[model samples]
Target: MSNEDIYLCIIGLCIVSYIPRVAPFLLLGKRQMPHAFELWLKYVPTSVFGALIFCSIFQTDSGVDFSFSNISMLAAIPVLAVAAKTHSLPYSIIVGLAAYWGLQQVM
Candidate 1:
């Protein structure tokens, strides 16, 4: 293809990709958000965290192995319990990471 044609193709691709991302906010405009939608939005964080934790805990280099040697998974149990009990982000992260490190050192 000619240089001009390639440039036009790139411009077209950019516009196509940008429309899906930008169109939603532009179309939503000043409309009031519905109650159900607002309620659903509240659960997004929890759902995202649960998915992330599940991915991290169960995923391994070779394959899915739920053996006793999974130190990170083991340490996360207490970390999750502490987080649920105290509702503290910093403390939970610190304790979880430290516990993982300690466990790794000993094993």
Candidate 2:
């Protein structure tokens, strides 16, 4: 493809990528959202985070990996426990990194 085509594709991609994100704010600007909808929005970040983390933690080059060999999955065990018990992001992060580092050293 020519440079012009590449530039146009990039611009088109930028527009498409931004529309979904911007449209909601534009449509909802300065308006009070319903209680149910507001309650539901609270879960969006958690769900999105889980979706993003699930694949990297659970999968590998060959296929799905749930074994102890996967340090990420192994590390997640203590992270989950600490996060649930403490409900603290910093503690969870520290535990996760430490767990992963320790597992990496051992394995």
Per candidate, the number of residue pairs that clash is: 0, 0
Best by TM-score: 1
Give a tens-digit lDDT track for model 2, residues 36-61: 98899899999998988898799889
Task: Please list the C-alpha lDDT of all candidates, in the order they appear.
Answer: 0.88, 0.91
Candidate 1 local lDDT, 1-107, one digit each (tens): 99999999999999999996886697677676788977997899899999999879877997775887998788898899999999999989999999999899998
Compute each candidate's TM-score over C-alphas. Answer: 0.66, 0.63
Ten residues in a row with the worst lDDT in model 2? 23-32
Record all residue pairs in model 2 with backbone atoms less than 3 Å apart, i.e. clashing.
Answer: none
